[model samples]
Target: MAKITASVYTSHVPAIGAAIDLGKTQEPYWQPLFAGYDFSKEWEKAQKPDVVFLVFNDHATAFSLDMIPTFAIGTAAEYQPADEGWGPRPVPAVHGHPALAAHIAQSVIQDDFDLTIVNKMDVDHGLTVPLSLMFGQPPQSDYRWPCKVIPFAVNVVQYPVPSGNRCFQLGKAIRKAIESFDEDLNVQIWGTGGMSHQLQGPRAGLINKEWDNRFLDRLIAEPAELAKVPHIEYVREAGSEGIELVMWLIARGAMADVAGGPAPKVVYRFFHVPASNTAVGHLILENQPA
Candidate 1:
């Protein structure tokens, strides 16, 4: 059966994608931010999984306010990069694992998670930025991404988004679904988005480092309890956009420790700020053997 080997979490800041595409990563302002992910790039090369089930929120590129699905999963054979205003990032098209994606959709829906099965859609920076962070810039000769990517988009843009606990529970269902697959594949689930920083209103450019670090701490050690966190706290403490962190709970709930197995090893943890006025948080947890 297929096994979920690890869960990766990070903030999918669009500006970071621009930094890479515009050849500005080495600029002093962006160097520190890129440096934080240096370990992640190296780690990816050594521990490349066959597939990555990435969770992110589509930023008005794929789904607008007119039609927003709380949860959507990409089941297409491949996805084109979305052209968000200033042309699409010069990134490779994302290939999907249709067979496994279909299986997961079947299993998760049977488990009572109402997921919108997306047969086709353009992937924006929310999905591509995380890929660029983990795998780095694709070479000029060949620009394909390192692994097959399965996009799982959550609705954090509009009101009435799923609660942290709900996402956590969904993660449990996803793990169960993946484990039941017959293929002997190594899979990784990635949750992208959030640290803090609101885009509009009077309190724009908010960065609660204290609160963000506390979130990372609780997420690592007390996920079940952390799942109980209410949405208001995320808004008051970490800013409205901070609610994106709940998506991380989805990845966390899929870890072995959450399901009465061995605790995962914390391979890497990073926190940085002010990337397009947002705090960037990242983590990697590798599941341990029974």
Candidate 2:
């Protein structure tokens, strides 16, 4: 049966994508940020997952204010990158795992988590940036992403977003669903978006390094406690947009340690500041054998 091999967490900053696309990664301003991912790219190569279950929030690209699903699962056979003001990023189209995604939806829904099943949607930078960071540039990697993907989008753009505890619980259900699959597949679940930076209003360009690093430390050691962190704290301390960090709990909850299995091995942990007004945080936790 299929099993979750690992959980990954990262900030999906759009400017990082711009730097990679415009051939400015080597520039002084962007060099430090991209360098942090050097080890991550190598790690991805060594741990070639058969499929990646990516959790990210749409940036008004796929779903506008008109309609938003708190939790949406993409069960499409293929996904095209959406044009976010600019033309679409020059990246390979994403091939999805329809069977596994559908199974997960059916199982998770039965588990009491409501999910909107999306058959067709154009993915935005929220999805592609993480892919590019992990798989490298389209030319350097492949015309297609290295592995199949299952896009799981969480709603963080609007008010009344999901709570950290809710996202975390859904993740456990996801783990259960994935493991029940008959296929002997290795899957990696990823939660993308945030390390604290408010995009608009008076707090624009806000960066609470102290809170952000503390958040990381707690996330690695005491996630359940971290999940209890209130939403107002994220807004007041980290910045309004920092609330996105709750999404990380979803991936953390899917790990082995959270399920009474052996603690996951932290293969990588990286944090860098001022990556296009946001702090970039990343982690790779590999589930250990029981």
Q: Best by TM-score, which number?
A: 1
Query: Taking the tens digit of each residue's C-alpha lDDT, what string does model 2 give over 36-94?
Result: 89898988889889999999999998899999999999999999999999999989889
The candidate maximizing lDDT is 1
lDDT of each: 0.94, 0.92
Model 2 pairs whose backbones collide: none
Location of the lowest summed lDDT over 10 successive residues in candidate 1: 137-146
Off-target runs (Cα >4 Å) in candidate 1 are none
lDDT of 1 by residue, 1-290 (tens): 88999999999999999999999999999999999999999999998799999999999999999999999999999999999999999999999999999999999999999999999999999999999999997998888998899999999999999999999999999999999999999999999999888988999988999999999999989999999999999999989899999999999999889999988999999998789899999999999999
Candidate 1 TM-score over all chains jointly = 0.99
Local lDDT at 136 for model 1: 92
TM-scores, one per candidate: 0.99, 0.98
